[model samples]
Target: MSFCTRFAPSPTGPLHLGHAYSALVAHDMARAQGGSFLLRFEDTDLERSKPEYVRQALDDLAWLGITWDAPPLMQSAHLGIYNQSVEGLTSRGLTYPCRCSRKDIAAALAAPQEGAPHAVYPQTCKTRSMVERGAGDAVRLHMDRALNQASAGLGFIEDGPLHCGVHPIDPAALLDEIGDIVIGRKDIQTAAYFLASAIDDMRQNITHVVRGVDLFEFTQVQILLLDLLGHTPPRYHHHDLIRDDDGKRLAKRDDARAISVYRKDGASPDDIRLMIGL
Candidate 1:
């Protein structure tokens, strides 16, 4: 199959050096394989996503010689598709309406339970009646129920620089750790990152997924959802992240590390590559 990958960035903040490293890695991988590269704007956070950030991202990518096959896909305009997927999961009894607020979840997780390594949402609203799914209630996947329904082992091939191997998906760990993750946040009127990105990958026929190592754990959740949705999961490449002098991962909020700022400082695209160790 032709190699296909994407560099998806949320426009909530400026594109920083970390973003540059990821985009260039994905871009170079696609070029090496003579495949397709896609640019996708993960602007699900409507309130924070800015048009100027989108433009800046495009300009930076162009300066680095990162091109795409077509116009960018914006998640904001594709709400219906994500909503339809949410409805499908709900109809199968794999999802439940969550009425608990952040504070409620935090309180529930304040005390760790025995045999559970980490605290997760107590599933306070998992058993709630679907009829109670109101205008403001978020939709969460019943992880246990979904896994049982799947009735098979889930795994993904990793070809990245770090931890490269076929990683098995542990449903038990997901249930205990990431229990009942929200799929559709009614409050925001947008699907969660995991749900939307997974759906979009399948929709775009992505053959390879290239992203930061920080997202390695979340890949299992996406693989679970993809299998439940009957879509073939793609091969993954979780590259090393760019960090600062203190060995902290770069954040989009760090304007000093923003690609635009570097461009303004007479930093060429080649300089960016060198700085990022490309």
Candidate 2:
């Protein structure tokens, strides 16, 4: 396939230095390889996503001399597609409905079992069939069955300089680390972040996924998701994160380090590239 990558940011907060670094890296790599660089708005969280933040992100990215190959894609606008993915998975008998809240899950895992590794959801609703799904129920994958169907020895190739290797997807690690993760929400109108992102990458024909190393741990689950969906995952290039003065990775809440603030303070695009060590 032709080279393609994307920088998808949720429009819930300011685009920080980390965002700038990621976007620049994808853009530069795409250009250098004569590939397509896409900008997508991962505004699936309707409660927190805002139109103003979307506008701000576009303005800031353009001001930084970055451009996309096509018009930006809005995750919110494509809910139907994501919804279908949820339904498709469910119909395949690979997923079941869940009604447990975060508190319910916390209570379930509050007490540790003897010599058991830490896990997320305790499978409170794993036994519930789709016919028994209630009004407020979320949808979670039947991870064990999924792994069985996906077969064994699943892995992905990472081309990122920091941690380049053939990383194997351990099913046992997945069952313990990310147990029956929420694929679709209560209303079934949208999907989880990882689920939506995995589907987006598949549909967009992305050949490379360039993001931060902070996401390395989660790559395995996404790879498994893609495999279950019968799609080949793109090569990943997980770069290092840009840290703040205290050496903490920057978050969207770091408004002081936002690209807009830097622009307002007369920091040019070249200055940003230099500051981010591009």
Candidate 3:
């Protein structure tokens, strides 16, 4: 396939320097490969995503001289597609309704057994039968079952600073570590970040995925899902993140590091490139 990559951002807050760094890196990668660059909005969080944020983000990208090949793909407009994916999983008995709240999960983790260092879902709803399941409950993928159904030793290639090679997916480690991750949010009636983004990447024909290193681990889960769904995984390029003076990753809440704030203070786009070491 021809090289195709995307810079997808949630319109829940202002565009921070971290966002700019990721977008610029993806844009540069596409341009260098003489390929297509695409823009997308992960605006599924209806409560937080606003029209103003979307408008400002578009302006910021334009000001940075990052041009896309096509119109932006909005996540909200494609809810039906994600719903269909969830339905497919549900029909195949690979997903189960989860009624466990955050507090319920925390309490379960707090009463954990010895030798368990981290807190993961205790699979409280794992045994619930489909007939007993109803709406208004979050849906979780049966990771073990899904992985078993997929081809053996599933994994993806990483082209990032931390891990730059092919890492095979270990079903045992995933089951003991990540557990059954929630993929369908009952409140939103849409798939979670992992499911929605993975499906969108394949649907959009993304051959190369570029993002920050923070999402590297989640890529494993996505690759598993893509494989189960019978789609080819893309080459992933995870870039370094922009951080604050305290060495913490920059977030949307950090208005001081927001791209709009920098632009308002008369910082040129070149200055941004220099700051992020682009």
Candidate 4:
């Protein structure tokens, strides 16, 4: 099969060095393999996503000599598709309504024996019937069933420059660790990151996923979703994240480290590649 990969970045903030490294790595990987490179805007977070940031992200990638096969895929335009997927999953009894708020989950986790990644759902509403799911309910995947589905002989081969190799997932570990992640927020009709991302990758025919190591744990969750949705799982390459001098992973709030700031400082695209050790 032909190799395909994508560089998907949210337009919530200006493209930073971390974004550059990710895009370049994905672009280079596809080019090296004589494959296709796709650019997708992960702007599912409608509240914070801005058109200006989207434009700047495209411009920044262009300046770095990255090119996509077609016009970039924008998530905002595909809300209906995500909604349909959500409906399908819900119909399959693979998702449930979550009434617990973040604060509620946090409070539950604070009690002894709660856990480290604090605030995991205590399944407060897990046993609630579908008829009870109301307008205020958020949709969450049924991790137990999803894991059984994904664990049935699932694996993939990853290809990329920064960190490349085959990575296999244990379905049991996925269920135990990732437990019933939210797919759609009741407050917003748009799909969550995990759902939108998995659907987008399959819909776009992406054969490889190149992203930061910070999201490595979430891969199993995505894998489970793909399996549940009957979509093929793609190869994955989780690269090292760019960090500040203090070793903290870069965030959108770090304006000082934004790529626009680096450009203004006369830093070349090559300079960025070297800075990130690409």
Candidate 5:
């Protein structure tokens, strides 16, 4: 495949410095490889994602001198594709309906055994079948069963400075680490971040995934999903995060670090590149 990468962002809030860093990194990598750079809106969260925010995000990227190769994809408009993926898993008995509320899950975790490893989902809905699935109930992937069906030694390569090497997946560890994670959400009839993003990565023909190191831990589960779905995982480059003066990661709440604020304060695109050490 000719190198291709994407910078997918949720339009829930304003674009911050961290978002700039991530987008610039991916764009730069694509340019360096003489390949394609794509953009996508992870707007499945209907309640949070807004048109204004999406519009502002586009302006911010353009102002920063970043250009995407094609028109961006809106995930909300493609729920059917995600549903098709969920159906494939459901048909294979690899997914089950989950009705556990956050409180219910917390209570279940609070009553866990002493020697339990990862404090992830306790599989409260492990035995629930799709026939019993009610409206609004979340659908979770049965990690163990899915792993069983996946090919052995499933993993992806990392080119990031922090963890630069090939990573191999451990089936047993993923069960405890990721557990039976939700593929379909309880709040809406859309795919969760992991499933939707992984599906897009495969379908978009993305050869590289560039994001913050904070998300590196969950890469294995996505890789597992891709392998189970018979698609190859992409190479990942998890970059260091941009933090505030207080050593905290920049968030949407931190308007002081928002890209728009910086732009309005007379920061040029070149100034941003220099500030972010690109």
Candidate 6:
């Protein structure tokens, strides 16, 4: 298959140096193989995603000389697809409705167990029957069943080298580290990041996933979801994250580092590329 990659960015804030780096890297990778590159807008977070931000993000990418195949795919416009996916999982008994709020989860995980994240979920609603599942609840995939399916004689071939941190193609380690994660948000009917992303990748037929290392852990969840949903897992290359002088990851709130601000300061595309070492 021809190489296919995407630079999916949420339109919740202005694009920053980190966004530029990720876009350029994915663009270069696709161009190197004479493949296709797609631009996807991850606007599932309705509370924050704005039309102005979406326009600014597109402008930033174009200013950086990154061209996509067609108009970008916006997550908001695909709510029906996401709903269908959720229904599929729910109907198959692969997902259970979660009613626990943030405080409830926090209180439950007061004591963290070994090998679990500090904000580990105690699965308070895991055993709740479908009859009690309500519209206000979030959908959580059955991790144990998904993992069992993922490890049940599953394998795939990568066209190129797999480079994600220190480990090399350690699928077992990836699964063990990443437990059950949210696939659908309670507040929003739209799919959560992992679920929407996996579905988008599959629908777009993305051959490789290029993003920052911060998302490396989430890849395990994605891989498991794709396997359970009968979709091919794309080859992944989780690059090092862009950090500030204080060794902190760049965030959308860093207005000073936003690409729009840089543009206003008359920074050229080459300047942005140089800044991100592209």
**Best of the candidates, lDDT:** 5
The sequence of per-residue lDDT tens digits that candidate 4 reaches over residues 166-262 is 6677766665666778998775477899999999999899888889988887787787778778877988888888999999999989989888888
List TM-scores for all candidates, in order: 0.95, 0.94, 0.95, 0.92, 0.95, 0.90
Error of 2 at 120 (Å): 1.6
lDDT of candidate model 1 versus the reference:
0.89
Task: In model 2, state the lDDT of residue 265.
Answer: 93
Model 5 lowest lDDT segment of ten: 110-119
What RMSD does each model have against the real structure?
1.8, 1.7, 1.5, 2.0, 1.7, 2.9
Candidate 2 clashing pairs, residues 3+ apart or interchain: none
lDDT of each: 0.89, 0.89, 0.88, 0.83, 0.90, 0.80
Query: In angstroms, how far off is 266's CA in candidate 4?
Result: 1.8
- In model 3, what lDDT does residue 196 have? 90
The better-scoring model by lDDT among 3 and 5 is 5
lDDT of 6 by residue, 80-137 (tens): 8887887777777777878988887776667455334355466778887656777788
lDDT of 2 by residue, 58-83 (tens): 99999988999999989998999888
lDDT of 2: 0.89
Q: Could you give candidate 5's per-residue lDDT for residues 100-162 as a string of tens digits?
A: 888887777776562443468888789989999888799999987898898877788999999
How badly does each model clash, as a count of residue pairs?
0, 0, 0, 0, 0, 0
**Model 1 residue pairs with clashes:** none
Pick the winner on TM-score between candidates 2 and 5. 5
- State the number of backbone clashes in model 3: 0
Q: In candidate 4, which residue ranges exceed 4 Å CA deviation?
A: 113-119, 160-167
Residue 220's lDDT in candidate 6: 61
